[model samples]
Target chain A: MVRHFMAALQKHKMCYALILPTFFLVFLFRYYPAFSGVYHSFFEWDGALLEEWVGFSNYIEAFQDAKLWRSFLVVIVFISANIVKMIPAIIVALLIFHLKSEKHQYLYRVLFVVPMIIPQIVYMLLWKFFYEPNIGLLNQLLIGLGIVEPDLPPMWLADPEWVIPSLIFMGFPWVGVVSVLIFLAGLQSIPNSVYEAADLDGCGILKRCVTIEVPLIMSQIRLSLVLMIIATLKGFERILIMCNEFGGPNGAANVPGLYMFRMAFMEGRVGYACALGMLLFGVILVLTLLNDKYVRVEK
Target chain B: MSAAPKWKNVQQELAKHAGILFVLFFAFFPLYIMLQASLKDNAQFGNNIWLPMAPYHWANWLTGWLAIKDFIANTVIVCVFGVLLTLAFSITTAYVFARYKFPGSNVLFYMLLAVMMMVNVASLVPLFTLLRDLGMLNSLISLILLSIANGQVMCVYVMKNFIEDIPKDLFDATSIDGATDLQVVRSVVIPMSGSIISTLAILRFIATWNDFVMPMLIMRDEQMYTLGVGLMSLNSGYDTQWGPLMAAYCIASIPLVIIFIFTMRLFVKGLSSGAVKG
Candidate 1:
């Protein structure tokens, strides 16, 4: 048995050699940070120096802080906005899927998904300019259409009330190309026989969509929902840039991801930042598992 | 009855086409705005922001390009080396996990998979500290390494699935011909994985090229900044130089636009596959 084991090891020596760097790098960069995040959350730190062990103090503070919970509420609002965006995305996908010819379908697909190639940061920044109260495209249009007075145009990203709404509206008509593609894939995957059966039953387009298509594409819907949840929870880049300041006009648009970043880097409250990080992780894990269970049970 | 049905058909077609047109406008509006803003000269700036019209400030492109040329070079270097290193490590690791029955392979693979869920802002805090401690701050190498490590989970997962789909007979036959495992992989596996390799390459290249947060956090030096970070600096540097700033945005986005135009099919396929598996 020992000789056989040796022979096996010899046979696969190249595999081990090849995978060694991957193992080392992933452990060093990924797993180490994740585990260290948990450990670091328990101790107070002054810059690079660990001051003292403060068990659950950070969590206690996090719980009591209205601002943190407010950030959570802000993120939930973002998630709901994302969820609301999915309806139009599905409708658009279905519309494209039912196009008269394959060429039209292909053309529209290319046109829609091509914008996705643009850097997301670019998208956010461009909209930031458009939210520039005076010369913004949105305000310009609103003025052109005589909808709002030129001098009194609403500040999109500046006002506390308008900040979150403006952020949500930045990607207006936000049928994300990826969501459309995913939904299209899901729509296409539904066997043609089901459509044929629906047609035989004298189903109208709206009826087919509501009764037949929606139920059939539940998996893709679930997938999109889960992805949206993960993205909204973790993505602070848009907020970081759009706000470009301290959490958008007095923390109105703050989310935990951005809050944690500010705590860690800006304030140098590394320990509390780690605690916030852990909380975000816990939420994501719980939500993902819940989604997985819910989707599985529905199926 | 025939006339009613025909009219209803016409209305339906009109609605479908109108919906398609609406999406087209929404999808292209931001890009169009960017292009328009980029092309506008100072005189045309406040007059009408809708269209670029004649007397285009084509010189703004030159100005923008000159300012951030080094940032573009940094992005290319990071993306090129990053994608190559990621592919080398991920492909080999994925092959082993898919084919070999080594001790603890399953455990390690699942560990990596678990890390996939952990790939988010939560890791950013610790990772920032780790890089600082390692003396890798403000270096493109830090961005490259971090991207490769973080991206490996998905790459390895997808590559392993693709490898497992290849028939066992091919590998067995090659090994029986006195070929080594590496030889078999090079001769048989790599050649069959052309589509997936290209898919992964394109995906990784675009991702690294466009990544904002990682580069923002990792590289503090202005000289080491990627295009994304450079653009942010440009936006913040001048109070309101929308002309040159928009020009830079357009210039920075051109390569990705060209890549997507050419590889639209493969890109979409890659995104769908990654999204599903992930």
Candidate 2:
């Protein structure tokens, strides 16, 4: 086997040459930094200088860190919220799929995708604007409706009690275009014969959806669930933009990713940040593995 | 029975439309308000909180254009160069992997696949340090290089599947005609894989254009800021200008909106295909 591999390598040297740049860049940028994160987690590096072997001290510190624990709790809430948030996309996709008219289905799909053209940063900023206490749309609406006094509008992002909720509420309706499209694809792939059989069985629309459509799209849902979990776990940039580095009042909305960023960049505790990263990575890995094991998609 | 069932179907269709329309309202409300508020001054916005006011503040767009034009230019430069380089390299790598039975090919392909699972947030500090050590901080070149590296994985994955589907006879015929590997790729693969290539390019372009975190970390000077960070700075000032800010948001989104206009079908196709496979 070794001799055969060597002969193949010698024969297709050009293939190796062709892939060299990609391999080199991926190693340098991706694999190198990934390994460095693990290596640096055991040190007392301050990002620029002051590197010393710390031997799991950083991880030890993380184990007892109250703020880190708080951030994890916040992330748990977020992951839960995101799971709920994903339902709207699935619902919207189902509605569009069951639409009687093909042209209207296409139109709605196009309209659904229109909002996605806005850059994510722009969308976040727009939400930030909405959450602005003074002269903001949400406050203005409340004041107009006489729900709250103009003098005492809720300080959405600034108030610790409201901050996490506000962050979750930022992307209201949560019908993400990509998620909708994914679900729609899954729904579209369902054979017409299944629908015919369901109809023959006197299945109502909702009943048919519950019994036939969603079950058929379990794989897509599982895939999106895993992706959403990973995204929520890794996402700090949103909170960083909306709530600032400290993550709202008293770090009420701080998740682990934002906390890691604050530690690494703001405090220059690079090694500790790497340790936190390792912990986050471990959680993500375990959850992913567990999901893969548990979330069996019946064909 | 037919009339009763038909009426019920109409009602159900109406219900579906109502539900879809209801969701779309919330989904589109922010964008609608952005467009409306972009046309109003602060006083006007204060007066008419929900609706578009007449005597539109068109000058706010001018203010926005002036503020973010440079950021737009920087982003375009980064995106264009990054997408092209990513495509060039990814095509070559994907082509070789798809066509050749080289040693360790499975391992190498899996190595790239493994990266899809690695959380980028974990590598933030180290990647920043790597950039700093390389003296690429505050440089657009760094942004381009990062885009290329990050974009290569998905592009390669998608393109490899795409290229593998192309008939082997085309490649064989080209190679038999004394065409070099590069020539074959240019003539056979490039021509055959245009739609997939464009789809990948659009995806990469959107990703690169929207990326702000790395740019925020690497770039110190305001002049080096991409649209993401630049838009943040624009909104972060002490006195917020609602009109000009919304206009700026519109400005930032126009490029993507324009791209979507032309490539809407291709984008949807790419997305659904990616969803099914990925």
Candidate 3:
């Protein structure tokens, strides 16, 4: 077997040669760092100097750390909120799909995509601006509506009670263009005969949607669910940007990812940061695997 | 048809329109606020927060432009070079994977696929240390190299499938005419995969452009900051100059908006296809 493989490699030398750059770069930049991260997690290093091997201590500390666990709890809230946020995109997609005129559907689709042209950082910052205590749109609107006095407007970001909710409410309407487009793609794939069959059976619009449209689009929804979960789990830049490095007031919005970032970059606890990262990575992997096993995608 | 039934149908259509328009209004409201605020001084913004005010502060745009121009230049250079190198490397590698039956090909392909599942944030610390050791910290070259390395996996995965679907006879014909592998790829692979290549390019461009974390971590000097980090600093100042800040946001978004305008059809098509396949 070894000899056969060697001969094949000799025959396909050019193929090997062509792929060398990709192999080199991926190994150097991706694989090497990943393995090094694992190695460094068992050490006592400051990232620049003072290196010492301490087996399992960092992991043990991570398990006992209440602040780290609190961050995980915060992320779970975000994940739940994100699941709710997926509904608006799905509903908008269905509405557009059922539109009688193809031209109108196309026009609405383009309009939905227009907002995505803005940079994501700009979007986050804009939301942060809205949450500002004075001269912010939300406070000003609340004051105008007589919900709150001008002097006593709720501090959206600075107030611990409002911080998490404000972060969740940053992008209002929540009709993500990618999710809408994905759902539309799924809807468009259903044969017209299916709809006609439903109609012939005297199915109402909502009944047809429940019976025909949704089951057929289960795979798309599952895909979006998994992607959203993973993205939410790994995302910290938004919190970092809107809530500052310490993760909002009294660390109300801190997630494990942001905590790791703070540890590694701010406090120079590089080894402990690696351990935190490993824990987060473990949660994501298990969640992804469980999702695959449980959310049986319909064809 | 009865007149009453026809009127009911019209009413249903009107309801649909209303629902869609209502959602669109909220989706666009923040952007509307940004535009209006861009035209207002702090005093005017304080007075009339909701509506457009008089004597538009056009100079705010000038201030915003001057502040972020260097960052924009840095980002453009990084993104352009990153996309081109990623494409060049991935195309050749994918072409090989598609055309050849080499030793351990399955193992190698699965290796590339496995990287997709490895959460990137987990490796941030080690990657930073790796770059520091390699003397690449605080450099645009580090950003470009890292972008190319990260971008290649998905491009190669997508492009390999695309290249394999090209007709076998075209490759055979090229080889019969004494074409080398390079020549065959140049003539056959690149031309046949224009739409997919462009799709991948646009996706990579957007990802690199919008990337905030890596740039924020890697770039130490203000001069080296990308547009995302630059915009953050622009908003982070103590005074909170609303007008100039909003103008800076608009300026930062112009490149992507322009790209989308030119490539809207391809972008939409690519997104739908990606959803279907991915």
Where is model 3 more than 4 Å wrong at Cα?
A: A1-4, A296-299, B275-278
Give the per-residue lDDT of model 3 (tens digit) for A1-299.
98987888899898888989898899888998888888999999899888899999999999999999899999999999999999889888899987889999988988898888788898888888888898888998898889988878899999999999999988999998888999999999999998888889999988887888888888898889888888999899999999988999999999999999999999999999988888888988898788768876655
- Considering every candidate listed, which one attains the maximal DockQ? 2
Please give, for residues B1-278, the per-residue lDDT of candidate 3 as tens digits: 69998898889888888888988999999888999898889999889888998899999999889989999999999999999999999999999999887778889989998898788988998998889899898999999998999998999999999999999999999999999998998999999987788878888888899999889988999999999999988887898788988998888889988888888877777777642243
**Model with the higher TM-score, candidate 1 or 2:** 2
Docking class of 1: medium
Interface RMSD of every predicted model, in angstroms: 1.9, 1.3, 1.2
lDDT, residue B118, model 2? 85
Candidate 1 per-residue C-alpha lDDT over A254-275 given as tens digits, one digit per residue, 9 for 90 to 100: 9988898888888888889889
- TM-score for each candidate, following the candidate numbering: 0.95, 0.97, 0.97
Model 2: pairs clashing at backbone N, Cα or C within 3 Å: none
How far residue B64's Cα lies from its native spot in candidate 1, in Å, is 0.9
Taking chain A of model 3 alone, its TM-score versus the true chain A equals: 0.96
Least well predicted 10-residue stretch by lDDT in candidate 2 chain B: B269-278
